[model samples]
Target: MSCSGCSNAVNRVLQKKEGVTSVDIDLEKQSVLVKTDDAVSYDDVLATIAKTGKKVNGGQVIA
Candidate 1:
């Protein structure tokens, strides 16, 4: 994200998701690290991120 507001908006949207546990945003890297449970899926996370009105470059699942 570009600024704290942007990150906060994203964080808020992500945190509202069912299984989201934590959200870490690195503005310099323009990346967000989200921790979630099995109740959340990769696509679901992507969709939720999209709801923040940000362009998602890409995303992956980390074991």
Candidate 2:
């Protein structure tokens, strides 16, 4: 994200998700780290991010 407001916007939206446990946004790296339960799918996360009107350049599942 470009600024703290952008990060906060993303953080707020992701934090509202049902299975989201935590959210870490790395402004320097322009990336977001989200921790979620098994019920949360990769697509679900992506869609949630999209809800913030941010263009997701890419994403990957750690496990």
Candidate 3:
């Protein structure tokens, strides 16, 4: 996710997914941080990656 290509790929696909408020690519941590409203569904996230021809390695939120 930190690679420019990965970031660009995610951005290109996420831009089309609804309710995507922002995306942050952290090269140092090698992670893609995505933020969105409650309207955004998990399937939409998966679909976005699918559209981008990339796979979501894994993700989870912690309180």
Candidate 3 yields a Cα-based lDDT of 0.75
Q: Best by TM-score, which number?
A: 2
Error of 1 at 22 (Å): 0.8
Error in Å for residue 37 of model 1: 0.3
Q: Which candidate ranks first by lDDT, i.e. highest?
A: 2
Sorted by TM-score, highest first, which candidate order results?
Answer: 2, 1, 3
Clashing residue pairs in candidate 1 (N, C-alpha, C atoms within 3 angstroms)? none
44: Cα error in model 1, Å: 0.4
The true-structure Cα RMSD of candidate 2 reads: 0.6
Error of 1 at 59 (Å): 1.4
TM-score of each: 0.93, 0.95, 0.74
Q: Over 4 Å off in model 3, which ranges?
A: none
Q: What is the C-alpha local distance difference test score of each model?
A: 0.93, 0.94, 0.75
User: In candidate 3, what are the lDDT values of residues 1-63, reduced to their tens digit?
Assistant: 657887788787787777988887776777777777888877777778777677677887532
Q: What TM value does model 3 have?
A: 0.74
lDDT for position 55 in model 2: 91
Model 3 Cα displacement at 34 (Å)? 0.8
Model 2 per-residue lDDT tens digits across residues 2-62: 9999999999999999999999999999999999999999999999999989999998889
